[model samples]
Target: MSLKQSPCKDEIIAEAKRLGFYKIGFAKVRSVEKASASQYADWISVGCHGEMSYLDRYHDVRNNPQQLLPSAKTIIVCAASYYPAKKQSIELPQIATYALGRDYHEVLRERLMLLADFVGGETRVCVDTAPLRERYWAVQAGVGFVGRNSQLIIPDAGSYFFLGEILTSIEFPADTPLTQSCLECGRCVDSCPGNAIIGNGAIDARRCLSYLTIEYKGDFPEGFSLGNRLYGCDECQAVCPHNSTPIFTSIPDFEPSDELLSLDKKTISELTPELFSMIFRHSAIKRTKLMGLLRNLKALD
Candidate 1:
């Protein structure tokens, strides 16, 4: 239902924008669409989720909002662009734009909590770790539609944004979904080094470079190509036409540190646990840990 947004929404949009969130939209809580939920089940059924067995473990909660917060009537989906003002040199092992700065969990959570306090309701906050289908809610909240790369593409804003949610006991008028889809160009599909962007807005994590490098904890197959990647890959998003003029993130926490900028082959070879702990103490790069990162670096060689 497209209820006309009242002053409350205007206030929310204003406060959220002031907090450096690129987009904020509201959605009424509902069961995930069967088609979408089924599609996810299919992805897992075929072992497409790879080693992230948590998707299977939390199947029910992931598909239902009520399971997460029984009193949640409205979902506030906020998008934070991590598109860097400056990027690392191509000579270095590449980290994804989202990981260039502080861990998003800490950054977005701290900011979103401020927003929640402003809204003033019994609420729960969820970032990437939560079982919710975040991109789906992004669409539901009218923030954006899912792109061919399986990333949420906010029209004219690009897909370099991270999504976080606030489930509230208070109900707000829900926004409508955007009727647009990505340009039909198949560049993202063709650009995938592992052919992971399956073109139907579904990703085959087993063949996804991001998944292999960051999520999957296993060794690569023989003759696999890790390319120049250090942690995660962004082959598809980089090639998308929508990302040509990125809405560079305004969040200061997203800016790359001098140490992250200096990362290269030499630095990677010298990646000591001490160095790793010190550098990535608050970085998302900690997800893979030093050993996993070393494994990926070795595969690249």
Candidate 2:
């Protein structure tokens, strides 16, 4: 990769801000050779990842970005706020705050592509779907540290956000990791109704409500209660001290639709295939599929 024509990290950061990203940081491509890597191995070994077999399949690429993009020299990590002051009523089955708005994958992709173009050369934009260790990179970039909940917590902006990244051949100065780590208050663990937080920055996915509601494809484990969640769970994040200040998103694309914010359990239970398709057309909720959603709703019964 030629350095003469490539833009600097600062210039890319400026572009990222102009595009409305809440937090941005850059890091040089490197192997994951630390406690986090070992923790991942342990998590898998203990079956903490549960039914997510993709985690096993992409183990190599997830640890080393060199495998994802051989020529990539730098990674630009970014976060966008998704917190909204208005929340769904208690009468309704809850949806995770991140999914309350339009699909973040789509929202982040458009803006990340713009930043990637500015960086020049070969580039890859990754949201959550990629096997990349996104939260690990977020910390390496100094944007934030990984909380016990296993989510990236930006000090000022909170944990209610989406993470995105740009992998490119262009080189840039890497930011130092932040000194700030989670407060270690154990709030997330105590607050989790499903008892999913198993300590050491790992979660028992079989008992995780979020994983059960969205990712796990098999039968709803008997005796596991969903606690009024129609789609995803946010009990752990809702109690985080870092998220108390409520740094709301300014991006229009992240704003929630009226139907999504007002949806009650009755509405969800009554949803027809056509209505579900039309309402969640481009939303991340589509990932669960209409039948999966109805199955989740049935658990609420």
* Native RMSD of candidate 1 (Å): 3.4
Cα lDDT tens digits, model 1, 117-167, are 887667889998889999999999999998888989999989989999999
Q: Tens digit of lDDT per residue, candidate 2, span 172-276?
A: 889998868799999999989788998766789888888989998877767656878877888888899988897888778777788888887778878899999
Runs of candidate 1 exceeding 4 Å displacement:
1-7
**Position 226, candidate 2: lDDT:** 80
Please tell me which predicted candidate would have the highest lDDT against the true structure. Answer: 1
In every candidate, how many clashes are there? 0, 0
Among these predicted structures, which one has the highest TM-score? Answer: 1
Candidate 1 lDDT (Cα, whole model)? 0.89
